[model samples]
Target chain A: MTLRTESRFADPDAAYRLLVEAHRKIDPEHGPALDAALVLLLANHIGDPAVLADAIAVAVKVVSPQRQ
Target chain B: MFQFAYRRSPDQDRSSPPRHDVVVVGAGPVGLTLAIDLAQRGRRVLLLDDADRIGEGSRAICFSKRALEVWDRLGVAAPMLAKGVQWQVGKVFLRDEQVYRFDLLAEPGHKMPAFINLQQYYAEAFLVARAGELPGIDLRWKNKVTAVADRGGHVAVTIDTPDGPYELEASHLVACDGARSPIRAMLGAAFIGETFEDQFLIADVKMRAEFPTERWFWFDPPFHTGQSALLHKQPDDVWRIDLQLGRDADPEVERRPERVRPRIERMLGHGDFEFEWISLYRFQCRRMERFVHGRVIFAGDSAHQVSPFGARGANSGVEDAENLAWKLDLTLSGGNAAALLGSYDAERVQAADDNILNSTRATDFIAPHSEYERMLRNVALGLARGHEVGKRMVNAGRLSQPSLYASPLSTPDHDAWDAGPPPGAHLRDVPLGDGFLTDAFRAAGCRFTVLRDGAGPEVPGAAVIDAAASPLFAARYGTRPGDAYLLRPDGYVAGRFRAAAAGAIPAALHRARGAA
Candidate 1:
């Protein structure tokens, strides 16, 4: 399926799932979450709402206290 | 009223004080440093960070001789040194077998801190306390920057604060917001490079046993699936351990040592240790294609994200700040053309790539995917162990050496880009240059000041920064009568000259003012 377009989602898991999928596509290795967080943060600004929500969902899943 | 701004602007009313000479975007180590450098230079400066507190992560652990020199210039390298453990040697192991080692402080009889393991939080906190002491130096916390606009002659910044959005226009904006710099993105700067597909767990644990405060690398970090764990020391009995996670991994499973303990115990020696904090990390060997976009400039992670394998991520960002700080000080005040800032982009971007390559080489060595590649690494590791120099060379690879670059700002000396003591000679890892420097005494973190014999070279506007080069005295440059090299405020090779080379020193200083 094509990438979906969604904005900030109330459910973090949903938003982050979208993010993790995008990250998997962008970061095949999945080593540096900071980069993923960065991509997700920027994606939130520039990505489709669905994409941003997905990233956020995945980010919430990954980054804890996750203070950059 | 007029206390903050030591000097006022022409556009200012007779009744009003000036805003500031410059407004540093983030109060991380880089931003605090720039504020300190400019403030000490008698310029009005303001520093801001989104977070109220200093760094909290086990980020950038190893500091190069260049970084030590910058610290020396700032005059606090000693106190910070007191806070860190000095290291000159690194041990590399392939899976369960310990294989090779390398010493950045190869030759003896030099003053420089080879590579230091200190938390970024301590460094930033020290800088914060230092900045607080200086008059006209104001650091604002929780100042989340939203947008930046270059208004012809100057740049304007708008921040989303807890109260309301406030606007502050300055001569320039130094964005140290890190890899995902919103300011840089707003200005449409290009960050180029791909993300690596390795997930690692970084845990700062408190260990009871003696794990000799040196960096130990496990080829296939014998923990949690096919991953590796890195063990090194931080001040206060804290040890930094990195464990790679599987592709389809869950953070919950990796955060607690209970799940990861067996894996770590198998790799190192035991897992009976108090855990501090756990973080899951993913590194991208990506960098901003450009460092500066108009009136705004990027520093630290905002500029690039190198794999943490080689300690390049945070250290290189610090280098970005150190390199840009002096130039920003000179240029932000309208002394140099705005074009001076262009070199920040040109030179640092190269350094970023160098950092990526260094991290890539180290990461690939321990965590190769292909059988052929893995076999080749094993052969290299086995072969190197047989010879002393070979062993050191392999060790150097693990310590993140042999990574150097020639940026636009670097004045190619007759000996420029020649093989330095390593597998590579990129900007980030050089022994603070060829002075009589040696061992942990050789500084990889201070603003190295090499005082050559005869008529010393003159570095025009070269500020003799205050430095406390302690415990790492062996790394200081030019301990010998004839040898000498000075590090810039940030920690790249700033200037190198003979005793009589003083005549060329000022020109080099000008060259150091900005990138080529």
Candidate 2:
């Protein structure tokens, strides 16, 4: 919520909750693929490649914390 | 000479002059509604119009949920409902093909009533006659406001009666005069706006065949130089038809049936139909630069004039009076300051803007800018039928009667969010159980309702405005479960949040308290 990541949202909301809702439709385990897809889709909307990279890095770090 | 009173306090003798807390300049829908709304609140009111007989012109045939709510508040909606036709579907004709249609019933019911097909004359006549019977209400026809001058603390209005020019004084003045509002122009207020170059012909006709009881528009006239025609069906096989006047077409020529008959035959497929009335209109999308200045306020076509396409022009004006009426009462009764009056412009300007957009959009499609515009609109209408999103978007355009009064000046809430409006700024959902948000506020008799979802944040001043997921409310507003929005006493969505907006309730209260 600190720096703007995307415009898919009217405003940033609890991302985990959105992911949970998006995942509830297809998968239960809350797959990393959906998280990655959401990050890339929102990243593309964020427009600036540098901003996208940063948000993606943060999102990846959040979803795949072992990489941290 | 003017006499002010709290109610229908009877005169002691012939020496006692007639008393009125407010004297409305006209007995049109807005004027009569204003008088009744005030009189119902126990304020003595006298309504006057220059016309000798009751209103006869069926000028505005479309009534919004906002208007219905006002009628309900006056306890007159049930009778109107018995006579009025609730239109739930909209059909558009791109030549022979039915290209665009919106099922208003597709949305669930809420507090709002679905759009009704009733003549403005009927509404005005009903309310005026009914309000006349009410104590402290005197509807004097043939009495016109000749001139008005502000006398410092009070307003002096001159009425040119058949007897003579009688002088009257009141606290405030409202100009609801039609396009040619003498009071607005007399006050030297600028009605800054544009007039559409395109002129059109409108006729009320009686046809033996049954046309669908919804408004139907023709984008491109199938015959004679490519103008368009719009048709609205009434109860007794009466259809109001509007034929667009093309760019090079002479409006003077088509002012009567002789020149217009062929085009009507070409577009509606019958010039043989019986004609009740025929007239030509040049749509002027204009508004007063200021709704309020000094003590005189403008309402109805006097303040803003939009095309008849979406029927928001006069309806919004009704809302203007409704909003101003309550605030006027409060201020006159020492409940609020005159600063609250500024919101009349704030909200009504936005409402006028809304009507302008909807009207221009509809007219733009019907009267295409170019061949490309015509083709694009035709194709969009073609696509609009098959695609649900397109249909919903099209439907959204049809129901575009939003009023934005979320300012610190006149809004109900003491709190306002400077950050900007919430997510549903562009989203329009009809009210539930309450009826159309416009009419519900009107029907509530301008009482503040706290709109909530059973348990939510409670604002100190407002009426609790909650949704019951009520089928009735949803039917008119297209609102769903867990949805709630608070409206102004005049029926504009003051602030709404799905789930909840960060500072909505407080923002509403701040605006309300500031207005109060």
Candidate 3:
């Protein structure tokens, strides 16, 4: 199956606020672990390994120092 | 006020109860419907129950369209539909915000709606009243089946009454005893499955509420913090509410009026509601491996059970009755008994699995087992606010629907049809002249019915209905003139063909009757 790339959120800013609000009570050390957990959970929800791998690659390309 | 009169069973004579064609244990909806259907089909049925009166409480409030059709065959749907609340729309919410709404029955021109909310007690009462009218049904109240012995050809059962005990023999013994089935235990059959740890408080309250007669489900509603809630309107101004209590909740404390009243108050925003019945339940999704054990068969809760989320429990049981009644009737009338019962086991086990799968998924979504699961559920719900895909993923009990039996009984499709129900699917009710299609089938007496759109060669041993003049028939069947469909006794399509293929209809009939 093809990986879905269309934006699902109607309001991206509102979704960002929800994501930030989820991490607001977390400490610096726990924050990374929570983020990692969230990533794994989302990956599981995505289910297809190829789609998840593509998503990971896209994130890495966006965050890389050379790209920045 | 209870309308149905409870009559005590006659004292048992020392000799023995007379041998019967079919002895149905437990006088609940399943057993009663089975008995009525069998009696209508010319089988002598003896119905026994330990209870003196109908079931208490507004248990199993939602009856699906298929179940209503089945009850219609048993001659009780008109009263039920008149008394019940029909609804199709369900709204799902995340906390205080409504995420999405769904219309279950989108198509028009159907006889019954997607579902009708009626109390289980009223359903049983209607079935009982219908059963009393049939000549061949012998209903015995306060008579319990204490001992069961599977004799090679028949089942020998012992009944215990207030006065004394009596022995009886039946060609077939059908167990409709509820989840805690003594017959299942007596036969050493295992009822096995998973039990959800989370408990839910179900309260049936009589109130004058302005809430529409629609299903309203909530995930972590503000009234009941961190737990899911459900509200449904039943007949007689009664509202059924379910509140999720965590795994460690004590059943005793959660059932008290002082505790339940506040939860209802928070949801209703008033103290006008009075409790009709309140109970705490930790539902288990379980079933016996084989519904048929020698000459003794199981139906309803005794055969299988699911968590009450999807309203699969009683509706599936009624379907079980519907599926088995005709098979048993044929068996008693010298049809191939073994193969027909085997088909019943295969078809119903598949249905039970389907219900269990849906119920389990709904439970997990409503009460997530782990922190990770909870996190993912929250994300999904958050996404559901705007995304269609996320809204589709939200499972507030995938409500009960009839499962198409992919059994050996169904004669496979010979040619491709674009629309309407396929082979193994129940015949959709369509308006025909002054009445509906099912009404005609009922008047024809639960036989193999062949419907043709226009002039067609008749198949032997099947009743033919000409639907050439009815556009509704043509639309639902997706048939042109001269196309025909072979229907089973239970109103399921056995086979369909464009023209009369020599020997095909008879061969399909043999397979459907389990004579092949």
Candidate 4:
């Protein structure tokens, strides 16, 4: 199945808030590591290679918009 | 308490002693189970132990489904099940907050429960009773081995009994002694690995409480802050509690009832329980360089040890007993002794390594070594409250499961299956007729079995269990009408076939028996 661009959560804003709150609970120095680990963990959870590849491309595009 | 009276045996007075087919040392779960299995396989066993009675306390309380299956083959699972507390759910807590609960066995339609908390003494008693019924088993208590010499083809053993010292000869001598194995020391075999400095206090408390029968584990709870704790309900109104007391706590001072009672009261929030047993232990994850040494063999804790976080000690020992028994029996019955015993060495060493790896990992997670490690652990526990991945990362304990043997005896599968237990894996039990698949396998004598979907092939000298009548079997085994699986004597899958040609069965059987 293609990666769904539409938001799946009933409260997308609350989901975002929860992620931020989780980061706040840990020490400031650990935030980046947590994000990296969470990304890897989520990648494992979303085991579909096509969807993961698509999500990665979309995520990288946000940082380098001009990249072909 | 279960007690066995010491009796005088004629072997003690015999000048030449006696030569036996198999002489098994120590009469704990492993020795008892091994002796029974050998006896069932038509080999006479001389089972010896130094102790006259089962040890007190609720040690090794958690017996896994795999262990129960082993006991079932020996005709002792019924008593174990009837007298033990069965559970599948376990909950984890971080500080005072509950993290997430886990269901060990989510899928149903299995013969045995996921786990049962039976006292070690009761388990041994049942095994002893079963051993007594089998005429091939000659169990002698108060018989301790003082010296063991490997005489190439046979083993010479010197025993010390109440009467005096005696000598015996064994074609195969199996040491099922405990962690501090005297035989292991006598042979001067090296047991290598890590030993944790952290100490944990285990107390078996007897009380009338309405707590649900589930494993409750905690990390830094209010009652016992800065350390982890575990609670499990056992049989006979006894609840086992483990409180982490760091490296500095004096085991002698902590073991006293006066010091232990307050901790129980603080944890239970009441002072209405009596201590049945209490002890302190440090984790030791280690194993011998080789489980098999010349004519003398090592099984159970004598061969390997792991941190008790996963209840793997007794369960893995039971699996060791099962794995070793069949191979030894085949060797004694004029099969290739070298090849078969070599398979045993390879298979059980693989299992011991797997157990040590898992238990060591769990212990590492449960008791982190440094501040950074503790922070990472806390991170996982905190994230577990909101994420499924975090729950997967949290390892209070990875409870004992049967080892999937990537063994030399297994004939690698030649056919493809969508979803089923592959070769070198334990067969998942399914409901067959009135009983279960495991029951049928047990009923079909202790030998290699051919489990088929329908009447496709007739394998000589192997018991056959037809899966045509049971749809559940097909579902579990991922089989059509022509599928068949070759099962080892220890219930491990040796090979599988999509369509049997009758001629292909002998070679697979040969490979499974280590005769290839």
Highest lDDT, which number?
A: 4
Residue-level error in angstroms, candidate 2, position B13: 13
* lDDT tens digits, residue span B342-418, model 3: 99999999999989977877887788766655765776676566656467667788889888889889888887788
Weakest 10 consecutive residues of candidate 3 chain B by summed lDDT: B2-11
User: Taking the tens digit of each residue's C-alpha lDDT, what string does model 4 give over B290-318?
Assistant: 89998899999999999988889999999
Q: Give all candidate RMSDs, comma-separated.
A: 15.3, 13.1, 6.5, 7.2
Q: What lDDT is reached at residue B46 by model 4?
A: 95
Q: Give the whole-model CA lDDT for all candidates, comma-separated.
A: 0.60, 0.62, 0.85, 0.86
Model 2 chain B poorest 10 in a row by lDDT: B1-10
Spell out the clash pairs found in candidate 3.
Answer: none
lDDT of 1 at B333: 58
TM-score of chain B of 3: 0.97
Model 1's CAPRI class is incorrect
Better candidate number, 2 or 4, judged by DockQ:
4
For model 4, state the Cα shift of residue B79 in Å. 0.9
* Model 1 segments more than 4 A misplaced: A1-68, B1-18, B109-111, B221-226, B267-271, B369-371, B382-452, B456-516
TM-score of chain A of each: 0.29, 0.48, 0.85, 0.84
What TM-score does chain B get in every candidate?
A: 0.78, 0.80, 0.97, 0.98
The better candidate by lDDT, 1 or 3, is 3
